[model samples]
Target: MNDVQIRTFQVPGARLHYEVRGTGPLLLMIPGAPADAGALAGLAACLSDRYTVVTYDQRGLSRSVLTEPPADQDVAVFSDDAHRLLAALGDEPAYVLGNSGGALTALDLAARHPERVRALVVHEPPLPELLPDRERWRAVFQDVYDTYRDQGAGMAMGRFIATVEGDGAAPPAMPDPSQMPPEALEMMGRIQGNLDHFLAHVLLPVLRFEPDIAALRSGPVPVTVGVGAASGDGVPALSARVLAERLGVEPLVFPGDHQGLATDAATGAEIIHKTLA
Candidate 1:
C-alpha cells in the first residue's frame, strides 16, 4: 500500500507540513536538525505495513514554515508541537521514535506529557549535558555557534562534525542524484537550505537543553534508549548510554550508526518491529 497523504496543520507560531501513510497503530518518526520529514520517508514506508506512520517537518524547516521570524528554537516548544500534532491526529497514545536531536525532543515530550506516549525509542540523542565532561562539550557547542555567526554554516558544521565523529565506519554514501527520485531530491535541497537556520538558531539552544531526568525516570512512559551498533565512543552513543543508565535500562543496540535510520530503512524497520513487539 503506497498510498500517502500530505497535510498541513497550524500550530502557535508555525504551520506544520506532515505526511501520513499506512494503517495500524500510530508511529511518529521525528528527524534531527537540517532534516525534514523526507529524511525518514524510507523508514516510515518500511514500517507502514504495521503502522500508521506520521512524519513531519519541524518548525522553521522545509515545508513547516515559521509564522514569525526565525529565532533560537526551544525544546519545550518542540515538545509541545509534538504533543499538539499527536492530539490532532489521534485519540490514543502513540509509539514514537526520535533520532539525533529529534531524540532530544522525544525525551522532553515524554517527560512533559508522559500520558501521550505509549512508548518512546530514542536513537543516540546528542545530550552533551549528560556527559562526564559536559563543560568541554558546552564550550565546543558555544564555539560552533560563534563560528556560525563569524564564518558560515559550512565552517560551523565542520566543527560540529569533528566533535561527534564516531569510531564506526562512515555512513553510506548518497545515491547518485540522477538516479534519485524527484521527491527525494527536493527533500535534499530543502534540507540544504535549512542549514543556516539550524546552525545559527537551533544548534546551541538544543545542545544546551537538559532533559528533565526526574520526570523521565519516574514517569509512566516507557523510554528505550538505543545506540547504533557501530557508533562506539561517539558523543551521541555515550550520551545514549548515560541516558539509559539514568533511566535504569540498558541501551538497546540497533544496526549501523547514527544515520542508519535514513540509510538502512529495511533493517531499521525490522529491528524496530521486534523492539515494539
Candidate 2:
C-alpha cells in the first residue's frame, strides 16, 4: 500500500478537496448522496497501489465550497462540477466510477461529454428512466420533498434514510436536528437543499432524458453496469439489470447494498479494478 496524499485545489471560485493515491491511469470516484470523499477512503486505499485513485468532496459537500449559489442543482450542474474537477486535475478521458445519484451524474457526463470520459462504471443508478413505474417513483420522490418542506429536514431525512435502508414502513427516530454534530448537520442541510433542487429541476427532466442505450452499447468507451449482490431484487439491482439490458451487456455484481462500495470498500475496489483492468 502507498501513503495517500490529501490535497485541496481551487477551482476558480470554489475550493475543491481531493485525495490522490497510487500511480497509474487516473480513476476518478464520484460519491453518492449523503456521503463525501471519505466514503471512498477505503476503496481508494485499496486501489492506491495500482491505480491513480482520485476521490473528492463534491461541491457543497464537506470540504468543497460552493462559490456561487448553484445556478441549477440538476444533474447537468453535477456533471459540470465533475468536468471541472477532472480538467483541474489535468486528467482527460479517464475512467469514471459513480454510484446511485453519482451514477446519474456520470451517465449524463458520459453522454454529454464523451470525450472527457474514457470509460464509465455505473453502479445501480436510481434513475427513473429505468423504472417500470416512473410515475410512482416520481410520486415517492415528491412525497419525500413535500415531507421535507412541510415537516422539516430532520423528519424528512429520517424517512428518506429509512426508505433507502429498506425500511419504508415509517420514518425512523432520527437524531435531533438541533443536536446533530455540526458537520453531520451541515451535510444533511446540503442534502436537503439538493433534494429540493432535484425534485424541482432534475427529476422530470431526467425522466425525459432518454439514455442513449445504443450509444452506450456501441460507444468507443468501455462501459460497465454493476449492482450490489446484497441489493437483492430491489430497485438498485433492478435498475442495473435494466441498464445492462438496454446496453446489450451483462450486469456485474459487487459486494453489498447501495453503499456497498463504501461498506465493503476493499472488495468493491478489487472488483472494480478487475473490471477496468
What is the lDDT for 171 in model 1?
A: 37
Could you give candidate 1's per-residue lDDT for residues 202-247 as a string of tens digits? 9888888889999988898888888888776767888999999988
TM-score of each: 0.95, 0.82
lDDT of 1: 0.88
Candidate lDDT scores, in order, read 0.88, 0.73
Model number with the top TM-score: 1
Poorest 10 consecutive residues of model 1 by lDDT?
165-174
- Write one digit per residue (lDDT tens) for candidate 2, span 1-277: 5677878877644677788888988888888764677667778888888888888876666677768664435667677878887887774578999877778778877877788888889998766657787677667667766787788655665655554555343433457888866745766665555554444444444444446676666667778998877775545566778888888888898887777886798889888988888
Model 1, backbone clash pairs (residues 3+ apart or across chains), number:
0
Clashes of each: 0, 0
